[model samples]
Target: MAKRGEALRAAHLRYAPRKTGSGALHCFVLDCSASMLARGQLALAKGLLIALFDRARGERVEVALICFGGARAELRFGPAVPRWWNERWIEPVGAGGGTPLEAGLARASQLLERAARRDPGRARHLWLFSDGRTTQFPARPAHADHVTVVDCEASALRLGRCRALAQAWDGACIDADAMLA
Candidate 1:
C-alpha cells in the first residue's frame, strides 16, 4: 500500500504464501499367511497394530495398511489419517494360504510412489510385519525415506529372513515380541 500510494485493488494487493509444515506418511505391510495364524502371531500383530495406530493418530501421521496372503496382496486401508481406526476394522483380516511377500512389497512400493509424487515434501516410512516364512525377496521401495522390518518369526528354528531384509535395505530391524514389550 505504501509503495502503491494509491487506492488498493485486488491485483495490487499482495499476500504472502502460508507455509504448512511437511507431513509424514506411514505404510504398514503385514504378512497374513497361514504360518502367522500358528502360535497366535497374527493376533499379536493385530494388537501391536492397534497400539501403533494410536501412536500415529497422536502424532497426526497418515497411515496405510497392506495385507498379503493366499497368493495375493490387498490394500486394507488408505494413506490418509486413520481417524476411526479400531479393532473392529482389523478383526476381519483373516490369515490363510501362502505368504506372497513380493506382492505385498510391490503394492506398498506403488502406493509410496504415488504418495511421493502427490507430496514430495512429505516424509514416508515403511513398516513390514512378517514372520519371514517366504522365499521371495523384494527390493526396497524407492519412495520410502525410512523402513522398519518387524521380525515376527517366533519359531524356535528361525529363518532370519526379516533380519536379512533389513540388513540388505540398510533399515532398522525390530523383533515383534520386543515391540510389544
Candidate 2:
C-alpha cells in the first residue's frame, strides 16, 4: 500500500481548484486532546500537518493552524506567515481534557473570516483532524468553500461519527489510520 504522504499527494493532485478568483487558503484545525496520545496519533497528525503545510507552501497557498485539547482551542500558528508552519514549534500534544470541537471550529471559522476580510477573493479550505468524540459542533460558517475531516480513531463508533460529521458539513472524510496504511 502507498504511504500516507503518497496517498495525500495523489489526492491533492486529483483535486480541482475552486473557480473563485481569490487565492487558496488552507487552514488546519488539529485536535490535541489527551486521547491522541494513545496510538501515537498526535505525532502522526503533526507530521501529516507539516507535510500538508509544505505542499501548501509549494503551491503558494496560505496556511494556518488551530489546536484544541482542553476546555478551549488555540490559534497556535497564524493567519499570517505561511512559513511559520514549521514542526519544530509544535508542542507535544497529549490527551486528557474533553474534546472542545465547538471551540476549535469556532476559532477556525473566525480565522477564516479574518482571512476573507483581508482578501475576499481568496478561496477557503478547512482540514479538521480529530478523534470525532466531541459533544458539540460549532455552527458551520458560511464562508468555508471546502472542509476535509481526518479521523484519527481506530474504533468503529468514532469512525462513524467522523463520517457523520463529514456528511453533515458536506465535506470529504478520511480515516487517518487507514490513510497511513
Candidate 3:
C-alpha cells in the first residue's frame, strides 16, 4: 500500500504547464489556525504542500512557505535556494491560534517581492491554503501575478467565505476536500 501510494504520488507529479511561458516563483501561504487542527487537516495540508513542492522542483519553479496562526505569521521556508525544500523540513506544521490571514499574506507578498527582485523574469504566484475564518483580509498585493486559493473547509458553513474571497480576487479556488476525494 505504501508503494502504491508512492507510485500514485509520482504519477501525479507530472504536471505540464498549461501555457508556454516563463517560469514562476510560487509562494504558498498556509493557515495554521487551531481550527485546522480539526480532522487531521494540518497533515493533509502538509502533504499537499510537499506534493506542490515536488511539482515546483520538476518545473524549476522557486518555492516558499508562510504560515499564519496565533496572531503571528512566519516564513518557515524560503526565498532561499529552491533545493532546500524537502519532506523532512516541511512535515511538522502544528496548528494553534487565531487565524492571521492579513499577516500571512503580507509576509508572502514580501517573499514574492524579494524573489522578484532576485529574479526579475520569474512570474509570481500566491497559492493560499486556508479555512478563511479570519477577521481581516490582507490587502491583495499588486505583485502577485496569479492567486490560487485552496479551501480546506469541509463543512458547508465554513466553505463560503474562502470561495467569496477567491472570487473577489478573481483567482482560482480549489476545494482541498474534493482533491482529497
Candidate 4:
C-alpha cells in the first residue's frame, strides 16, 4: 500500500485530455500536370499545400499526399504525421505531361478504402488540388468522409469543371486565387 501511494506522485500525473480531431486523416491529391505549370498554377498549389500541411500539423491530424502527372499517380507523402514537413521537400515535384485525374482519384480511393477497413471510426477528408484539365469525370471516393476541390485554373476562358465536380460530390469548391488572398 505504501509503494502504491508513492507511485502516484505529481511528476507522473500529467493531465492528457482527449483531442476531438485526433483520429482524423487528411488526404491531399495534387495535380502535377503540364496544365498546372501554366499561369503558375503549380506554384500556387504548392503554396496551398504548405499552408494545409501547417494546419494539419497544428491540429495533429494524419495526412497523405498523392501527386498525379505525366503517366501515373504517385504517393508522395504519407497517411502519417507531418512531423518533419518542410517547403523544400516539394521542390523536386516537377509538373509535366497529361493530367491523370482518374488515376489520382483511384489511388486516393484505394488508400481511403484501406484506411476505412483498418479504422471505421476515423474521419477522412480528401483535398483535391487541380486545374480540372482532364476530360475524365471520375466517380467520387465513397470512402472519403468529406471532399474539397480547389480549382487551380487561371485561364481567361474558365471551364468550371472543378466547381461542377465539387457540386456533384456535395463538397466545397474554392478558387485558388481567393485562397491565396
TM-score of each: 0.89, 0.80, 0.80, 0.87
lDDT of prediction 1: 0.91
Q: How good is model 1 by TM-score? A: 0.89
| Candidate 2 ranges beyond 4 A from true positions | 1-22, 91-94, 156-159
- Which residue pairs clash within candidate 3? none
Ranking by lDDT: 4, 1, 3, 2
After superposition on all C-alphas, the RMSD of every candidate to the true structure, in Å, is 2.8, 14.3, 14.5, 6.1
List clashing residue pairs in candidate 1: none
Tens-digit lDDT track for model 1 on 25-137?
Answer: 99999999999998888998898899999888888899999999999999999888878778899999999999999999999999999998888878899999999999898
1-181 per-residue lDDT for model 2 (tens digits): 3445464555455545555544588889998887777777788888888778777777777788889888988887666536656656775544578789988898988888887777777889999998777767666666788989998876534547777888899999998866666
Displacement of the residue 97 alpha carbon in candidate 1, Å: 0.5
| lDDT by candidate, in order shown | 0.91, 0.78, 0.79, 0.91
Query: Across residues 123-159, which tens digit of lDDT does each residue of candidate 4 receive?
Result: 9999999989999899999999999999999999999
Which candidate leads in TM-score?
1
Which candidate order results from sorting by TM-score in descending order? Answer: 1, 4, 3, 2
**Error at 40, model 2, angstroms:** 1.9
> Which pairs, if any, clash in model 2?
22-121, 33-95, 34-94, 34-95, 34-96, 35-95
**Candidate 4 lDDT:** 0.91
